[model samples]
Target: MTDNIWTYLMVGITFAIYLGIAIWSRAGSTKDFYVAGGGVSPLANGMATAADWMSAASFLSMAGLISFSGFIGSQYLMGWTGGYVLLALLLAPYLRKFGKFTVPDFIGERYYSQTARVIAVFCALFISFTYVVGQMKGVGVAFARFLEVKFEVGVGIGIVIVLFYTVLGGMKGITYTQVAQYCVLIFAYLVPAIFLSLFATGNPIPQLGLGGQVTDGAWLLDKLDTIHTDLGFKAYTSADVNTVDMFFVTAALMLGTAGLPHVIVRFFTVPRVKDARLSAGYALVFIAILYTTAPAISVFAKTNLISALQDKEYADVPQWFTNWEHTGLLGFEDKNNDGKIQYYNDKNPDMDAVAASNGWKGNELTIDQDIIVLANPEISQLPAWVIALVVAGGLAAALSTAAGLLLVISTSISHDLLKKWLKPNISEKKELLAARLAITVAVIVGGIAGINPPGFVAEVVAFAFGLAAASFFPAIVLGIFSTRVNKEGALAGMLVGIVFTATYILCFSVFKMGGPEDYWFGISPKGIGTLGMIFNLVVTLVVTYLTPAPPVKVQEMVESIRYPKGAGAAQEH
Candidate 1:
């Protein structure tokens, strides 16, 4: 079959399965809507958690980032992986034992203040919306190329599909659908990676292939380094970023992963605290399968991309190039009217002589990094079915996380804002309706944001992680571990952390207030969250000492969650 036919078949079949699961598992009550009736098995929840955790950023953009940024991109791999370990060990079990429907729910009750709850709600909404924008962008990119539609139109389609399942089934539908999505995305990711690995290094395992020799008997990484330096770019194995910034970015991502409300909420669906722990373990295994292979895929794709396209004739370019060009994500301008492509770092001083000698006016090829993974299969001349499968996987990764984030947004409004704070006596049916309505609005807003995102998928996601790290990490950690952290402390800390981080990101990234010289203490906006998190911790500690301690009941509640009986009972209070 043609690529279009295979894409439609795979996408249609997978989407049909998702919709079927949604209908089958649709929530009938507030409890079901919020936590899938709180009876999910550990294995199933683990799969769902894996799917939820691996968003568009993980499946689509991580490899692409590594392909271009070289060793500096290891920060993403290390931070996110370390962050998941932090979440599994430090946060998941305790939060599950606390038996809350959402992160805000835990903060509100644990701190004994509706004011604290409201602050957490705002933080959750802000962080989730920022994160979902990245997922929406991923969806648009996939659909635009494979489905042959405008990027905006692809986002619209994604919004509709996510809205259908998310609104109809709520957490119940999303959970089971994510389990299926895990299978699709993992399979999609591994198939192409394995193919490329075997073709590149005669090894079936991508991880092994990364270190194996290429056809010409040179180490793969060495060849990549030669290619990179030849093109006037840094060696693929070298780190160009400073150590402090790398540490801060890695720390922010780690803390952010632990504090992400959507991933945290997945534990609530399970039946017991032990189940939560088990699911966390299972999720780590599932997640590692993709995470470990990412660098290898990065190496393979980068080598293939450079070998195929660098300095190639524009007219004689491969079919994939023309296909991607029509989508507007890939372009070649005949700079110097040479009718040839130049893909290199033109700004590099060392390359100036090379460019002049070669009669290259300037680098004339434009390639969006987000397209690398999606276009990898095509660039490597994989079969049509593999390409189609990748499109489905990209959509699966995007939609699963989008559903999870939108659910967090809706739950914050409907549960935290309306039911818990504004109208404590609201009916369950009405609250469920409110949740659906809230998600509908969030989907539209997210779709609009996706159309014109502030940055690429990974960059935008890094910002969201920064926000989560600065705002939620401190509050949750203090609320659980420290008995003296009062509502005033938690509230003040979250407000300050989020405000400072958001302002820095806005100034540097969004507004372009100054160049790299203006970075505060040599920290970029992406890494400033580490500083904000420190500020939050310091403020929380100081405020706790200055103000009265949390009430005796709240302190006891914290103690109870920390040391629950029988691997912690999972029944909600």
Candidate 2:
């Protein structure tokens, strides 16, 4: 079959499966809507958790980022992977033992204040919305190329599909659908990876292929570095970013992963604390399969892209190039009126001589980094089915996370804001309606943001993680570990952390306030969340000491969740 036929076939099949699962598992009550009736098996929940955790940023953008940034981009790999470990070990079990429907539910009751709950709900909404923008963008990119539609139209399509499953099934439908998505996405990722690995290094395993020598008998990394330096870019193996900024970015991502509300709520779907831990372990294994292979994919994709396109005749370019160009994500301009392309680091001063000698006007090829993974199979001349499968996988990764995030947004409004705070006596049926309504609004808003994002997929996701790290991480950690942290401390800390981080991001990334020279303490907006987190911790600690401690019952509740003895017992709110 042609690529278009295969894409339509595969994507249609996957979407049908997702919709079928949603129909089969649609929630009938508030409990089912919020936590899948809180009876999910560990294995199923683990698969769902893995799918939820691996968003468009992980499947589509991480490898692309790593390919361009070289060793400096390992921060994303390290931070995100390390953060999952942190979440599994430090947060998941305790939160599950606490037996809350959502993070805000935990914070409100634990702090003994409706005000604290409201603050957490706000933070959850902000973080989830920011994160979903990346997913929406991923959806648009995939649909734009494979489905042959405008990016905005693609986003609108995604919003409708996600809204259908998310609103109808809620958490119940999302959980089972994610389990299927995990299979699709992982297979989609690994098949192309294995094919590229064999083509490049004669190895079937991508991990080993990364270290193996290429057909030219040179180590893959060494060859990549040569390619990069020849193009007037930094060596692919070298790290040029500041060490402090790297550390901060890594730490923020790690902390943010632990604090993400969507991931946290997954544990609530399971039956017991032990089940939560087990699911987390299973999720780690599933997640590592993709995460470990990412760098190898990065190396393969980068090497293949440059080899196929650099200085190539524009008229003779591959069909994939023309296909992607139709999406407006890839373009080539004959700047020097030379029919050949010039893809290089034009900003590098040392490349000036090279450009002049070669009669290169400038870097005339424009390739969005987000397209690398989607374009990898075509660049490597893989089969049409493989290319189509990748499209499905990318969509699976995107829609799975989008559903999870939209659920969080809806639950925050319907569960936290309306039911818990505004109208404690609201009917369960009315609350369910409210949740669906809230998600409908959220999907539209997220679709618009996807059409007009502030940055690349991974960069926008990093900002969301930063916001989560600065705001929710401190509050949750202190609430779990420190009984003395009163509502005042938690409330003040969350407000300060999110506000400061949001302002910093807005100034640098949104408003174009100043250059890197104006950064506070030499930290970029992406890494400033670490500083905000620190401020939150310090403020939380100081306020706890200055104000009265949490009530005796709240302190006892903290102590109860820490121990595993009675973790299976149901706790009263």
Best model per lDDT: 2
What TM-score against the true fold does each predicted structure earn?
0.98, 0.99
lDDT of 1 by residue, 1-573 (tens): 998999999999999999999999999988788889988999999999999999999999999999989999999999999999999999999999888888999999988999999999999999999999999999999988877877788889889999999999999999999999999999999999999999999999999999999999999999999999999998999966688899999999999998899999999998888889999999999999999999999999899988898778888998889888877888888888877788888889999888778888778988888889999999999999999999999999999999999999999999999998899889888898999999999999989998888888988999989999999998999888988899988888999999999999999988889978989888988888899999998998888899998889889988987888744333332
lDDT per residue for candidate 2 within 85-171, as digits (tens), equals: 999999989999888888999989999999999999999999999999999999999989877877778888888888999999999
How many residue pairs of model 1 clash at the backbone?
Answer: 0
Candidate lDDT scores, in order, read: 0.91, 0.92
Q: What TM-score, to 2 decimals, does candidate 2 have?
A: 0.99
Error of 2 at 358 (Å): 2.1
- Summed backbone clashes in each candidate are 0, 0
User: What TM-score does model 1 achieve against the real structure?
Assistant: 0.98
